[model samples]
Target: MHCSVPYPADHPFPIENLPYGVFSTAQDPEPRPGVAIGDCILDLAALTRTPLFAESPVPAPVFAEVRRAGSRESVSNLDAFVALERSSWRAFRRFLHGILSREEPLGDDVLVPRTSPETQMHMPITIGDYTDFYASYEHAFNCGSLIRGADKAMQPNWRHLPVAYHGRASSVVVSGTDFHRPSGQILASPGDSQPIFSPCKRLDYELEMGFVSGCFCLSIGAQARLTWHHMQIYGGKATQLGQRLSPQQAQEHIFGVVLLNDWSARDIQTWEYVPLGPFLSKNFCTTISPWIVSMDALEPFGVGQYAHEPALLPYLEHDGGVNYDVDLTVEIKADDDEYHVVSRSSMKHMYYTLGQMLAHHSTTGCSMRPGDLLGTGTLSAPRPDGLGSLLEKSKLGREPFGLGSRKDMTFLRDGDSVRLTGSARGKGYTIGFGHCEGTLLPALPLLD
Candidate 1:
């Protein structure tokens, strides 16, 4: 897609990758939906107010609704856009693509554009709930071996279903927000008679990606199923009581993918996680990238899913399994004023695809709400350096990850900054999630 606006040839925000986000400027402090086109943000709200978008080949349902209601202002979040149907999603993108492309160009001067650096990004969606799934086979196997020993490595049910845990949505922060190290109860030894409350001794980051939704609500009791059939995926929760989502089309409901860093307190988690799963250890903080690269922009990067043993259930089985080929990386910038590439991996290492995770998530009919995040727990590969977390790279803090010959680290220090990035490569451009980053702050002083 050729565009009049100038952007770096290799920039992530190309005309073909119009990822959406919530942004504000010093002049306009109200957060509104915006699309990243090249290096500038195409103000969707402003565009909708003009007669140009009103001339789209297909009806623009999202803005049309707002226009009919006589509201010229933009909605504060993706709530309105998320409610849009598949056709509307396509129409909106097609309209923007058409206008931005040379085929049916519009004047760039009237769109109320903002250079990226001048604008501030906010939480794209008011996340209703969050769930982190252990979907990477290599990561799961490595961590399981380190924790449960080589003989008992993976759980019996791992191969059959996508395992997950409910995450704390309240702690889900947007990228650029640094957080203090969390403190929680810990056991001094494996068989300790008593527990101690203290700051985390082992702090780490999980390099993963998450998907948000625009579909209806899903609850555990009712259970939600991702009906993936005919190249369609619906986010609407299971409202028919026991009605299950089909497996024909499971990709439709997903808004897009974002880089996610699920910070972990290994000491606290190792002590508390058991039959009940992670609790206080996980509720403190989770970081996500600002922009959401919609599924539409990623369709070109899709390929057949990786092979796995053990047959999947009928609900989980589908033809032409789809998965994105995205390259991922993590880096650490410490107090020494240097950034070190700690690990580099790819999303293709994941044992189960995002669709499988969503399908398993709602298999019980759990209703998923718009902005609900589903994390692909710690993406890792078979190589030691390809591991996602310090736990695996350091072999549980026993070894140090190398940063040249002079520097090494087993776990993060107070001033350490970790950034996660990922992108789907295209012919001459890239579809990317800019950055999901967080700095480790000193934990608050402990009580006497």
Candidate 2:
């Protein structure tokens, strides 16, 4: 699995972890897709210049479509590429692995200068739809206990199905993008007669993992077959395609993983969310690591999906491991120049696996587009420090925690920065999503 690329022992990007992202250099401001390899970016646009891509067994119609339509030079947006079948994805990766090997058989001409101060990163995918799932056992339990009495913490249907809500895809941003604190109606005091419209009083971040959807071949007609890839590009309802996706079929549709920070305003959520799920409190911003580590790359670190206490139904059961043992960490940094690890947890603590989530989502035959994202909800562990959100850490602000600065607070303050990182260790490699980070800016003043 080794390649000639000079990856340091501790580097997040390795030959084995060729995560993809969209980037641009100062000289060429137009964004394009590139692959992370150690300190440098393997420019996909530049790769097309070489004979490798043309020589690979890329699906004909897909490649032909790209060539026929003079698109952007860089594979900058991976939406179209991700829609290809698994075989094509593997073929593309193999071609990359060989060229990146020590031999430099293709020569170093295609390499882009290393990512640095001059380079700019963009959102890797044009997310069509976003769904955030409350799939973690510890996170859901802790949040429930804090919000409701322990006696009635777990919702009756929580274990029976993967609880989720459709998220705002328009506001999803890449890492390092700062956003102003969201303003919303909040109850100034508990049991207040009326609510006040003001800035969020309890701004928080949810540490979670995100997965991107890819291509899936569907058995449509009795004698004919169609890949979900074609269905999406052509446009059709998945349910009309005639069959529900099995767990195994659902897993094949996963493209990759990214670190996700689902920003929340606790006060606003508490006031408004009763029957309906998250709305304004979450729509202001949702940040994600720019690079997406392909499912193929994460395969080596995969572990079996956790067993369901109340055995899952037949549709949710699958043949292989769906979870990866990725270590996730959240840190907060302030102007005082101090960095502190606020929480540490593993993705394996999730009660429902991504495959299960996908299967459940498609049970009704809902179509999943190439760039749709599914978020594994706040991945907290049973340990005290592993709590994922400030609501849990501060227990609804009754207690506050220190943030390296002299100030001990429950929620985020303006200028406070939050960063999340995730990685899974393999034989000699660390497969990781570089960082999902954001800084909170002062709330905007209201118009007169």
Candidate 3:
């Protein structure tokens, strides 16, 4: 499908892939919802003001409500849009695909040049809660083997469930934001009796993908059988607080996917992550791409789930293509200002699928909210070149990889910048998460 809006054939956003985000132009300073269509953002706010949605099979009010709820503040967040019924989501995506594929060119009023200096992208969703999962078998095995030896690489419970930990939603930021290198307690040497408080000596980046959760439909017994649209309008009939979700039910809860960079301070993590999991090592900053590629758009690129040794529990078992074959790459920029591709991986390497991760999360009746995030941990591959993080590529800093001019490179430097990008290729099109990137700043001095 060709888009009337002119762009390269390989452009990440096309008529087939209308990823949503919040953007503001200099002329229009208020952030508003938009979808990237061939290098330009199709202004949803402007489209809503027009009569575009009048002919849609889905009620115009449904689309209007999402826009109104999301566009209320200075920085428009897609939380309200995420909370909409799944049917509305499908209708909206189809409507967008229909218009952009038309032969007639769209007007400037409804299109903003994405690369223009004035077009500013912001965090698409106001995340309520975040969970980071260790779901990659290769990544888990690599890290475990490096730390505890190959004999104990596979944790006893690793094959059973998708292991995860609650993450800090407050520190979740949009792409292009800079963050300081974290300072925390770490062992100065292997034999050190006590840990020393200092700036992180081993700073790293994790290449991962995250899925945003959609609406929370209250299960009102038989009334739950009501049409999703009517149930959305009536706000449902029950006040059930905690309810378990099967793998099939959990599939509908996912809104979209984005590239995620879970920055890590390895030294801090090594020192602190003992009885409990990662704390200060991870909570500092986690970056995500602005655009969210809808689950509908990703359906074309679906692939079979990775092989699981032990049979999955009934709740986590699902047939068909649960994982996506999105190609992921990590790059680092040094003083020269040119990005060097460091690692190449794929989401297909993930042992646990996003559906399984979400299903396991809510299996205990934990209430999940709209705009909640679930990260797929480090997506390392079996090959050495496909390692996701520097810790793995560098073998815990013992073997430093070579970059231009700087041969000894293991961890991130003060001025080094890391960028992560992902895309799934299709017949003459691409579905991509724009860019998840951030620069490292110098750490602050210790307390006096």
Q: Give the winner by lDDT.
A: 3
Task: Tell me the alpha-carbon RMSD of every candidate.
Answer: 4.8, 3.0, 3.6
User: Model 2: runs farther than 4 Å from truth?
Assistant: 55-75, 105-108, 221-243
| Candidate 2 vs candidate 3, lDDT winner | 3
Tell me how many clashing residue pairs each candidate has: 25, 3, 0
lDDT of 1 by residue, 199-279 (tens): 898999999999886554323244344453310222344333444444444456677899999999998988878779888
lDDT of 3 by residue, 1-448 (tens): 8678988888898788889898888998888888898779988878766666555665564666655744463235576677676887888777787777788888988888999999999988777689999999999999999999999999999999999988898999999999999999999998886999899999999999999988756453332322433234333322134566677777877899999999999999998888899999999999999999999999988888977888887778876637899999999999688899999999988788888888889877666666779999999989978999999999999998787777899899999999999989999888888989999999987669
Please identify which of the two predictions, 1 or 3, would achieve the higher lDDT against the true structure. 3
Full candidate order by lDDT, most accurate first: 3, 2, 1
Per-model C-alpha lDDT, please?
0.77, 0.81, 0.84
Q: Give, for candidate 1, the lowest lDDT window spanning 10 residues.
A: 229-238
> Which stretches in model 3 have alpha-carbon errors above 4 Å?
54-56, 67-75, 218-240, 446-448
Q: Report how far off residue 147 is in candidate 3 (Å).
A: 0.6
Pairs that clash in candidate 2? 4-102, 32-76, 33-76
Tens-digit lDDT string for candidate 2 (270-375): 8888779888988899999999999888887777777777987777887784688899999988758677899999988888878889888878766666678999
